[model samples]
Target: MTLLAAVAVGLAVAFVSLGAYVTVRQQMYRNLDDSLKDRAVQAANNGVLTNYYNLQRISSDALGLSDIRVGVYLDSGQKVNAKLSPLPPMNATELAVARGTAPDGYSIETVGTPNSPHFRVVAVPARFCPREDDQACDDGETLQAALVVAQSLKPIDRTLHNLGIVLWAIGLLGVIGAALAGNAIAQSGLRPLARLTAAAESIARTEDLRPIPVTGSDEITRLAVAFNAMLAALARSQDRQRRLVGDAGHELRTPLTSIRTNLDLLAQADKRGGLRAEDRQQLLDDVRAQMDELTTLIGDLTELARDTPQVRDAELIELSNVVEDALLKVRRRASGVEWDVQLSPFPVWGDERLLGRAVTNLLDNAAKYSVPDDTAGHRTDGEPLGRVTVRLLDGVLTVTDSGPGIAEADLPHVFERFYRSSEARSRPGSGLGLAIVKHAAEQHGGMIYARNAPNAGAQFTLWLPHAATQSR
Candidate 1:
């Protein structure tokens, strides 16, 4: 920027100075030419063309121009001021004017030396009639002559040289001043960018998500606003990361401790001669159950830990198909609980795999809650618990279980990660099922809500938009 500013200033100064110098020199030369031509004409009209006795006096005193010189020449090569000649020899232009072959002319002359002073010269044709005793010279043809005038150009040259020096000095100062101003402006503009860069670098080095303070509304301030928004998002993501890690660690510890205790017991029993088959089998079953619970918890954490899915790749699939698939799988796993399902054709844009996962989690949670405490009696169809009903219509899908409804106090936090109620703590499942359902619904631009049904059962309604919004 500074270089460009300097170049622009230099060009402007150069052009302006060059134009000024050329104009002043031309005007000066023009004024000098006019004076010299007028004086020469006056000397011719004053009989200096026919008589050359007072040529020097007429040029210096009569013209009041001491630096001016005058001469007269005829077509026959005769000079008026023959003895008092103060001008150079007539060149072709002056000779042509005297001989009536060319018009009046003006020219410049200088000595043969390289640094010789210059002179401004002019020649104009006139009648050179001399007085006689009986008559005056009347033949214009024979009286043809030219008045020649010359003026030294040293003063004009000196003035033009001084002007050139002055213009050069002024132009130099202007360019320097422009360069300095440009640098200052560039520095002022870049100071904010420097702060922004430093803040970004500090964040990169230390993982801080602090926002930069904003001042006036400008392009830089707008950029800072956008950067602050990005920092806010990063801070949110960082918080989610910490929470997921801490919760995952806490959830994994119980199963791991139980498994370790069971292993130690088995090891000690092996050292003290083998236990009874029944007791050994019971210990093995307990260990297996705890391992399965751990596996399930880990899987739920993994599913919940996935970042938002790419909604652009989602296909428009029938949501009922996903729900039906979930019901089929849940029925096989939960044999004691009866299933009541009603599906309708509901088109929605969503990822098939994610939607299916969400539906399956919903069904599994419903069936897990609906099963009777006495599983063998319910399997034999003796006083069976109510069925898990899944209904789908339009863009809404509802799964209701015939179990104790959610507590009023637990309703708000049902979808929170790793959140569990007092009653659900004794169940054999992770608490991330509803959270996953809520997340998947939101990813598809939908929502999930829980309510107590009229049958004293908990009902989860998952509503999906017809067109999924693009996810970040």
Candidate 2:
């Protein structure tokens, strides 16, 4: 837009300058011609041509035509005695004027040694030798000679060219000024947008879904009002989601606890009866496994609900220690899994318990899906075993396993709640484990991703910025 405005202003300035230049040039030339004609009429009226020498002297001294040559011709078309000698041959129009037949006006022509342009004014009288007896022309009086006054216009032409240059310079300055003023106008007009952008960034940084201040009574102000209303709606919706997750988790916790307790009591009673011992033990193991899956799902829902900025800000924890602790917990829960813990010092800003839980969920997922059965000799004495590696490096936590890696098509949605691969549906764990990990990463200003490793396994990596350990 600024470019367009500058071009428009420049064109307008050039047009006005061209018009003024042409008008001034025309007017100046016309005034010069008129002045010359008036001088010729005065000379004819005052009888200056009667004394031709005096006419020459006055024309040179008083009219600033010192370089201009004057000529007079008698009615007989013969040159009169004058100041300049040997004048060029008169054209047919000039000869007619000398014979009292041409009109009284000016003519432009080229003359002089270098053949420069010249303007000439010719005056033809009715009678040059008027009889002294009458004030008017006598009956037998003949027409008088014609007087031609010619002047060079090269100097005036040079002045007009210079004046054109000045006008163009002034026009250029006007265009530059117009461009600057346009930029200022555009900036001032868009100030409201800049303010709104700043406010939006502030809200994003603070995670504060608050109303934006109104700037004016214009459309921009109405946009700000709409934005504030949207923020309010989003805040309410998020609050409702968090509350639902918390309530659902709370409602399921008691029932899951009772189910696990009752299953334990049944197992103890069957063991005391000693009837069909192996079958009872197997039933008890299945009930406990189901209860464990429900417990894990409930815990994941509770963690997801609590994964908020406020909860993350309540603690400063080291991720390396959390990874090690989670690895230890996974080894205890799934003793059949082989663990390789590679730790480093990685301080991050997050609740210790939440970070530990997130790491444990990742490991538990790897163990549940990837552990080999006893027939493969990968497990010893009915203990299913597979390799799990946990590492922390450069503010990043990575957990890898020698399990059937997730397919490439399923990688994108693995972190979504309740998403499970088709082959892993029979696994004894809720699919929310990775979802909780993702939420925990985000709440701590981090990100998490899952990918297949190059050598036939799956890897999960979590990244947190170093500034996460700093103060709010």
Candidate 3:
């Protein structure tokens, strides 16, 4: 930034200085040309180059023509040098003036050696005529000689040299000022970033998940706010991890204790000279049931413990096929219950196994909560028995069950891992099924929302983008 500013300042100063110098140099030359024209006019009228010579010899400064050279170029090929100082050799322009081919104005010429001095000169036409008694030369006569007046440009050169020095000094100062200002600005602008870096480094070193203060409304401030939000999310995730571990431990203990007690009872019976056949088989069955519950709990815990869903070799597959497969598995378990499955040909991209599991869990949940009636018109819940409705339209798959809906208090936490409400505590589940469905939905970039149906039961709506194939 500082370098850029310095470059910009230098360029601006260079342009301004160049323009000013050119203007001043042109004006100085104009002044010099005016002085030369005035002197040439005087010399032309006087005709006595001798008087000007004597005047210059005494004091050119007193005559207001310091270092001003005078000369005459006669048309008859006679030449006279100025007495004030030797002027540069006459060239084509001077010759033309004497020959009456060029007008009188100003011309610059190099005098003497190769590294010669330069002079500004002007020529005025001189008429060759006999002077009258009053000493005024005839103006309308034939041209005789040309008066050439010249002056040294050393003073103007010196003035411009001094101006160049001053301009360069000013430019240098401006560049330095710009550099200083640029440094100050860069420091001020990067202060927030420095703070952010320090905070991040501190977190890396200490592993703290504390939110940072957001102080401004700029992009940097927005970044800080986002950082704070990330910290907050990390805190919440850690808290959830702690709670999940505690809940998993508590859930595992129950089945483990039951299995241990059943095994101990069997061991005692074997030590007492073998137990009755029926009692031993019942004890073995109880142990098997506890083991099965343990296995299911462990499986659900493993599924929930995965940080990300296992979606290996995912591809575009027919979603309806996956749903049909899940329905086939669930229909046997829910054979006694009414099944109202409406499958549609929806195509989506995801792992077939994971998607199938999610669909099966939803069906199982509906089947588990449903209390089937002996009569088709009556339910134990005193509500008319209705079938679980599954439909796929566009990209949305809705599963609505005619069972006890979620309570208002437990609605928000139904999808949370291991979160079982009081009403659902007696149900045979690890409470990870809904969480798995939720994870699958999120991994597929879809949404799952549960709301109670208006007449009865609950409706689970899953919206997956691009689930249905586009119509050609």
Instruction: Give the best candidate by TM-score.
Output: 3
If candidate 1 were superposed on the true structure by all CA atoms, what would the RMSD be?
6.9
Model 3, residue 229: distance off in Å is 2.2
Worst 10 residues of 1 by lDDT: 103-112
Cα lDDT for residue 16, candidate 1: 100
Candidate order (lDDT)? 1, 3, 2
Considering lDDT, which of the candidate structures 2 and 3 is the better prediction for this target? Answer: 3
- Candidates in descending TM-score order: 3, 1, 2
Model 1: residues >4 Å from true position, as ranges? 1-179, 309-316, 347-349, 371-377, 467-472
State how far residue 438 of model 3 sits from its true place (Å): 2.4
TM-score, candidate 2, is 0.46
- Predicted candidate 3 versus true structure: per-residue lDDT over 321-403, tens digit per residue: 88788888877766545777677787887777778888999988877766543342334454434467788777678888877
Task: For residues 1-472, write the lDDT of model 2, one tens digit per residue.
Answer: 5666778899998999889898998898788777766776676666655344454344444545454555666667766533543343356566667675665433334344446454443444423543333244444654566666666667877899799889988988888888888888778867897899999999889989978878678887888899999899889878868765665666466557767776777768767884477766776676676676677667777777654655534566777778877777777767667777777787777678877888888888777655753332245776556777777889888888888899988999998766778877655555678888888788777889999878778999998877554565
Off by over 4 Å in 3: 1-19, 26-65, 70-80, 89-114, 120-150, 178-196, 214-223, 263-314, 349-353, 372-386, 467-472
TM-score per candidate, in order?
Answer: 0.62, 0.46, 0.74
Predicted model with the maximum lDDT: 1
What's the residue-level lDDT of 389 in candidate 2?
77
lDDT of 1 by residue, 1-472 (tens): 7888899999999999999999999999888877777877776676654453344334454456556666777777776653344664467777777887873343434322446657777777767754433244546523778877777778898999999999999999999999999899878877888899999999999888988888878888899999999999989988998999998898899899999999999999999997789999999999999999898788778877776654557787888888888878877778777778788888888788889989999988888788655562246635445578888987889899988889999999999998999988877766788888888888888889999999788999998876444332
How far residue 398's Cα lies from its native spot in candidate 2, in Å, is: 1.3
Per-residue error for 394 in candidate 3, Å, reads: 0.8
lDDT of 3 at 20: 92
> Which 10 successive residues of model 3 have the least lDDT summed?
50-59
